[model samples]
Target chain A: MKLRRSERMVVISNYLINNPYKLTSLNTFAEKYEAAKSSISEDIAIIKKAFEESGIGEIETVTGASGGVIFTPGISEEEARSVIEDLRDSMSESNRILPGGYIYLSDLLSTPRILQSVGRIIANAFKGNKIDAVMTVATKGVPLANAVANILNVPFVIVRRDLKITEGSTVSVNYASGSSDRIEKMFLSKRSLKPNSRVLIVDDFLKGGGTISGMVSLLTEFDSTLVGVAVFAENAQEKRDRMNYKSLLKVSEIDVKSNHVKVELGNIFDK
Target chain B: MKLRRSERMVVISNYLINNPYKLTSLNTFAEKYEAAKSSISEDIAIIKKAFEESGIGEIETVTGASGGVIFTPGISEEEARSVIEDLRDSMSESNRILPGGYIYLSDLLSTPRILQSVGRIIANAFKGNKIDAVMTVATKGVPLANAVANILNVPFVIVRRDLKITEGSTVSVNYASGSSDRIEKMFLSKRSLKPNSRVLIVDDFLKGGGTISGMVSLLTEFDSTLVGVAVFAENAQEKRDRMNYKSLLKVSEIDVKSNHVKVELGNIFDK
Candidate 1:
């Protein structure tokens, strides 16, 4: 496992990037790479400088015996805003507008590059929070939740509209469906989430906020706490009451007749 | 963005790891880091050696004026086997068995690290193919498909058991429901996939292969070609017709009455 200093840094940086929000001792790297602790420390110093200068993230070195260096993935405010702006423009395409005022986001959400960027932006918005798990309603929100969960290094739970036998015992909650406005039940596997989990909720789109509310209730049902709510886009014209969440794109206008959709950067960029 | 040689290697490795299955010209790196092309080439030489020695992946340099370096993510067979073995043991846990013999897999599939590893293993199984999209059924299979799609840097399309208005128009196919042995319809959004795409099918579990068949039919319906099929696990005891797919874990036995399940490494490791 002995590596040259440059190769060691490359491998160490890869490890830190893959295992974000983790603490790794310099001794461990020194032993693995067969280098001196002082050399490892120097490597960390250079890595910290490179990461910070590139706005990739930050690395903190703890001095105590039980401490080590921790890497926190981050996205600069400027970068986050630019990413969302690009998404907003792409989302405003007329072809994305389906009948009944729905926008087709599957294409964008399914792209890894876009998902990775969006994940970084959303995770950055909720940085410094203790997130034990990410929760999202089934179907469209799974990938978004998965992306955020990946960045956070936490498990994600999916809330399904229909119960499946494979989920085993489940707890159900009734919420007003956004599309049909009917009282509908959503189910979460009983074993999917642990109690007292601080969860961050993520979804692809926020319309009536009913789905998000249902998930919040599920959090309470599982004895978990909500850290925050984030969505890819929100319908600005929709009359929503008493719900606060961060969205990357705001769909300000959707004229189905003229095939025109107006989109702007969402409130995540607001100071 | 001009960084020292050591720092540049770290950032370039990060970029390559994040953007696998992508071709990037040395000129791009040279321009981005404000370094000479020869220096960037030297950096890649070190990175390629580091990556190969660490089992990270392979960096192939394509020659000619239109040539560049393409990073193909890979895992050592030993590591892949060990990962699947660990999953096999975990899947064999008695508590994973639900009613009817279905094993709960949400926890494993939802974990980012596990998904990333599984994604790499599954993607590596079909490494030589030209896969344009990863296809799977909704809810349970979305994350698995997303994981594979992320590794491949392609879009994933989810086929739903029930239709949603948000999906716009969809192409529906009838397949025998594996659990109930009843005919059911699955729908894929018309816009979700393009025609003539070479798709790789992935799912959380393969029971009767009906769902995979449905997706295959849908692929044909969309004028797309099937590159291959991969699953996180497959039911070995299920009496299935001839189906060619790679699975990481095989469920040899599921004794619901005694709450015991037997799992082994699946066909993914088969030569």
Candidate 2:
């Protein structure tokens, strides 16, 4: 594992990139690379400068017996805006407008590059908050939640619309389905979230806001606090009680007759 | 955004790590960091050495007009075995056995750190294959597919048991549900995958092998080729015809009465 100064920094930065929100003692790196603690410290200093300048993230060093460096993943505002702009443009395509006016986003959401960028943007929006887990509904929301969770270095809990035998004991709550407005039970494994935990709710798209509200109530059932809510897209035309949340894209209009869709950057970009 | 050699190396390695299997020309880095192509070449040389030594991945240099470096993510056999061993131990927990002998696996699959490790291991298993997409069923398989797709830098297409309006027009296939032996239909969006794609079928668990078979058929329906099949775990007790696949863990027994499950490293480790 011994590497030259240049090689060492490359591997060390790679480590920090993969392991965000983690604290690793200088001794660990020093021993792994057969370098002195002072050498590792100097390496961290150079890495910190590179990461901050590149907008990769910030590296904070802690002093004391339990001291270590923590990597916090981040994205520059310019890069975030650029990513959203691209998404907005992609979403505005007339072909994305489906028969029922539902925009086809599976193609975008399932792409790893898109998911990773969206994850960084959404996770950066709530950078200062202490998030325990990312929560989302099954199917479409799973990849989005996983992306955010990867960046935040937290677990993701899926709220299922249907009961599955694989899930042990679960806590269920009825929430109105988005456009249907029909009350539907959402289930969360009882063991998934601990009591008094702080969670961020994430979803693929927002319409009636019912699904988000349902997840908020489920948080209450588990005695967990809602850190915040973020969605990939929100329908501006959907008339529903305004709940505080962030979205990467806002679909102002979906014209099924004309096969047109108007998309704009969501409220998350608001200064 | 000019940086010193140390800083440039850090950011370049970060980019290669995040964008694996992508070819980035030295000229791009040279222009970005205000360095010469020779300097960037030296940086890649050092990085390639470090990456190989640490089992991070391989950095292949393609020379000529389309010249650049392509990073292929990899893991040492030791590292992959260690990861599967940890998963095996986790899966063997007595409390993981749910009623009717179903093993609870949501917790391990949802944790970002675990998911990332599993992704690297699984992606490493198929390092030489040309995987255009990672295909899996909805819900439980989504996170695993996302993880592998992230490492491979490919899109993951979710095949759903129940169709959603947002998926648009989809192609459907019938399969027998594991354990239940009841026939069920799985759907994949027509636009989700392109024709003649080389797809890698991934799933959370392998039961009766019906789901994988169905996905394979769907790949045929789409005129795509099946590169391979990889599952997180497989049930050894399930009496089903043997098939070609790779699994991280093999569950030999799940005894509900004793509340015990036996898990071992799977065939992926076989010499």
Candidate 3:
């Protein structure tokens, strides 16, 4: 007996979710269903369109010989919040994350699987939102931006903390980050973004949300809109709102001088 | 008449090269050849494996009910030099690239198609090199690193100009970049790389070879071996006879403060 289209999609999505590295070709699906190749093709097109429309997963096609589709695991916003909370739980156990009242995420960001999963969850939250680009302040934010951009297939623009010989003339924006008394200048090339582009702002960590706001102001110079802001980790003690933004993990406070800290996972990755 | 494995591989590869975006499935190939689905599937497997072994292009699979394979266009090292030389020819028409004794690649790096081709060519040069990682300095190098990493399926790592709160404790190194007066500091997290890793260094441009040397030194601290070095452009003048690396385009010289420049395609893409 042949399965209904809905049934097939569910089965296929489940298969992709479980077998992350495995790829399947159309012939394989057709044989499994005892359906005509043409019908299978139609069914896949439907599934792909559904995935795109639903914004839960991405279906990539491989052509020529040895081609198959791999389903990337994605989560809805509510589900994403739970996952972030889980990571927060894991992070809170480590006393090393707080040294001098700061949440250290360098080790967390460097791990591939964590970054990959975090990236997917974050990207899924804004699927099909027509984000013109992903932007981040340079260095630490590059990898996070890269992961998000890869999932969305959009270009990632890195804003420099300082000018380099290669960057030519840059439009500089001034913003204070953390407890630094002096205002720091962040720069993006005038030509990096097009006019009226919609940008998704992402960063590894948020302390005061000052850098995030500065990026927002920077985007305005290009007439770009800020569609969303996401951070892998955020600290609530900073008393900065923009609670409007999505964060995977939230750190309430850290007493580095005393080596004590508190953490709260935002409800972003509920699953 | 049905096409044999060799014949199909060539034709399919050529088709992928020409069409670029259009992906045809095994079922489609079977229908085109009047062969059974099984036979076509087998043929595709062979082709995909061959691409992996030969490094001509990538065979990406699209799984699920209607998923199929797609070809991502890639070039060989020989082809890389040819394309680079073409760009070199165009860049040399005027001294525009040599403004202030530097070949400005900001405009080129920002261009999508150019970056795409450059990435493919570099990937080709390193095809089958067993590269474990792609490493680059921050900012402009990120785009090029992304392209090479995507094709190679290796993680790309970025070295920071300066450490931030997110980077944890960083291991810093100093190196002279070409003939520059000042010593530049490059940094990486102590744990970001494993000891004795095989790394491929990729950058957008090379001037004094100082940055490349710095990257090499940083890798050495982790006991990492330099597998190879690739750049989109290289300086032809003041050539270092002892260095082993590949550049897509070779720059002869740029008259100081003039828009005059000369360049040629490097031998890495000799074919």
Using TM-score, give the best candidate's number. 2
Instruction: Write candidate 3's Cα lDDT for A1-271 as tens digits.
Output: 3554433443444344334334688888777756776776766565565554444466677776788776654656555566666677767765555345666565555444455568788877776587768888876787688667655656678788787655556799999777656689999877678899999999987877788988999998889999999888777667674446888777776766666667787545554
Residue lDDT tens for model 3, B138-246:
7778777866765565567778777765556789999875676789799987756778789999987777788888999999898999999998778767645366788
Model 2 chain A scores worst on lDDT over the 10 consecutive residues at A175-184
lDDT of 1 by residue, B110-173 (tens): 9999999999999999989999999999888888989898889898998999998888999999
Candidate 1 TM-score over all chains jointly: 0.98
RMSD of 2: 0.9
> Share of real interface contacts recovered by each model?
0.82, 0.95, 0.13
Cα lDDT of model 2 by residue, A1-271, tens digit: 7789989998899999999999999999999999999999999999999999999999999999999999999999999999999999999999998888899999899899999999999899999999999999997899999999999999999999999999999999999885664888999999899999899999988999999999999999999999999999999999877699999999999889988899999999788
**DockQ, in order, for the candidates?**
0.84, 0.93, 0.10
* Docking quality category of candidate 1 according to DockQ thresholds: high
Rank ordering of all candidates by lDDT, starting from the highest: 2, 1, 3
RMSD of 1: 1.2
For each candidate, give its TM-score against the true structure: 0.98, 0.99, 0.68
Show model 3 residue runs off by greater than 4 Å: A1-98, A107-119, A252-271, B1-99, B107-120, B253-263
Q: Rate the local accuracy (lDDT) of all candidates.
A: 0.90, 0.92, 0.69
Best by lDDT: 2
Q: On residues B115-182, what C-alpha lDDT tens digit does candidate 2 reach at each position?
A: 99899989998989899999999889999999999999999999999988888999999987876569
lDDT of 2 at A95: 90
